[model samples]
Target: MASDPLFERLWNGSAPMEEWTAAVSDGAITAVADGIITVHTTYFCGSVTAIRTMEGLVLIDTAKPDTAQRTLEVIRSWDDSPIHTVIFTHGHIDHTSGIAVIDAEADARGVPRPRIVAHRNVRRRMERYVASHGFNSIVQGQQFNKPGYVYPIGQRQPDEVYDETLSLTIGGERLELFHGRGETDDASFVWLPERRVLASGDFVIWVFPNAGNPRKVQRYAAEWAVALRHMEQLRPAILIPGHGPVVFGEARALQMLRDGAEALEHLVRETLALMNRGATLDAVLHAVKVPAEYLAKPYLLAKYDDPEFLVRNIYHFYAGWFDGDPAHLKPARTAEIATELARLAGGAEKLAERAAILSEQGASRLAVQLAELAGAAAPDAPRIQAIRASVLQKAIDGESSLMGKAFLSVYQRQAQERAG
Candidate 1:
């Protein structure tokens, strides 16, 4: 379905933006007309930006190690600016691991290692990566499909750390850093006061905010909004994001940031209000809505992250896991429910037939629920195969968003496996 192009594209390798040109060239770097420099370090993983001043070349974030070599080559091609400082927006692997390449370049040229700076919390986050490598590998496998790829544990820790705010002058350029929590606990954004440019790492990914990754560590929705508001105050004319294309102009960038923040805040506030009133988790999830205004925004659409997940994240943030219902405290197993439902409906065959009827009548949500129950009840039944196909096709026809597309693909795979 159109709503879930990312999932479909991943499975089929036909994503619309897969070949879209990077705002920055591959294996090359360039300085913008505003004097801010940028490099598209990796296609979808990370980027590096720099600004030249009398003090030195101040870099914002680095690409992944695998991508860093090419990124450095690009940077060197653009300017011979001496690397005197590095500012890490966060401790995410893609943004920090590439420092080795930069270090090697400086050392080879007989220049001193650049001073690394980041938010104080970055140190703890890096330590957590080392402490939980196995857990992170497993989670990354699920999210990225790369199993057993051990992310490097030895991080290039920051030499300079700040708590709330820090200001510096790099090569005569004024740069200000502010701490704001978002996808990560130690997220920070850089504001260029004179050039009116902002290097927003991961905070504004051009697409939707990745605030509700189901498999990752806890994300900060409340803090994400706070960060956006802080950036809005800066009124930067040029916006260089962590991923995706760079946005030019102040008004458009601010509008995008404001809309995104408002969308997340609305979901968080509404979900929390319902939970505070003792509503069940399901009730709160269904009740929270992205305001009508943001639904049409191209950049805020549910392309990368779904809104339902965001609502669930908010619920977990405020109310914890219990749904305030005793029935779910130690609930019946899913298999138990499926077996009972199948028996009540006169076996899996009858349930499959009912699912087919419901699907034909455009009751896709109910049809899928019934089909799942029937499939689990009769794993090898021919009727189960039919029900699976019918339910998935219905979903593919009706669903929207990347999440829905992924679910449809998964169901189709299950149907094929059962048939075989």
Candidate 2:
């Protein structure tokens, strides 16, 4: 794990400062060699890349606004070259909010505002953001700890939007932009012909592709696979992703891209088949699986997004969330179920005792459910305290998703308070 500092950071987050510092120093960002340039802007969920052409700097995605200011500061530290163009790979907040910061910097310096370019869908995406700001805030609350989301005000729309492909010359080098639907409908990838470098927006995230985020907007797994195949044919020498460290070799990059696409395709096809056969959503979800060979790939590991979530996403795509179970069509509320479960278990203490046993036996799923009931039924019981602790400890020991880990943290805190 310590050997590959980037993987270590992505996986267990256990690398020493010196190792990570060395990895970052090894040109993770702001790489300048052979008069060609690349910059990796680190932001949450996404990153930005900048390339130096003979004409001026061509920036790919500005990152979050605050992060963009810091990114620009870093770029200035290395070279005083003016940013001639800014390409928005997608209209997601993390990718587009930094436009204002870049605009401010260029404006203050009396440099013309860099040309902002994106796919034609970018304007629609921005419009959706403006229209659904409240919905976004509510959905985002489940993930973010802040009381409210910081909605970007006066977001800059793309100055140039294209449907198929657009070619631009920067510093006498030809950079090609291609539209594709992947993590978002508005995704675009930049191909640097001279450098043989590909800046894949969120189209090729290094982590398990987040095609099935349970909480966010629609993701295009089928289209994402298609895009990966398209990029595979290009055979990029250096693959700078929307997140995580860049891949250095063409063969390795192609293999990762191909494997990821194939994995998603398998799931999409299998899920569709089961749905076509009138299988229940649960049956379809349980049936979809990523081949062991593909899962073995280091880049395709389920570090961030779980495959099961993507399976559910596919089910939603086909059948819009009615699970065919008549009872569940308008199911009893959670509190009602908890009350009944509490009554059946003979109050919270018995339920807590059962949960503790389940936790001890490694049945964490059942344990968590029982613990929740116990906590609701007997909020002040010592058994509730014990159940919470046991459930939380199991969660901490397991390899769960990010949201699972966060929920465990919340449970652990609540348990400690009860114990006190």
Which candidate number would show the highest lDDT if scored against the true structure?
A: 1
- Runs in model 2 with CA error above 4 Å? 1-22, 25-34, 41-45, 134-153, 376-386, 389-393, 407-420
Regions of candidate 1 where Cα sits further than 4 Å from its true position? 1-19, 22-30, 33-35, 41-43, 145-152, 349-362, 375-400, 403-419
The alpha-carbon deviation from the true structure for residue 75 of candidate 2, after best TM-score superposition, in angstroms, is 1.8
RMSD per candidate (Å) reads 5.7, 4.0
lDDT of 1 by residue, 288-387 (tens): 8887668666566566677777777778877777977887999998778889988988898888888888999998878888888888888888658877
Q: What is the lDDT of candidate 1?
A: 0.77
* Clashes by residue pair, model 1: 3-400, 3-401, 4-401, 4-402, 53-171, 53-172, 54-171, 54-172, 55-171, 56-171
Clashing pairs in 2: 54-171, 55-171
Q: Pick the candidate with the highest TM-score.
A: 2
TM-scores, in order shown? 0.83, 0.85
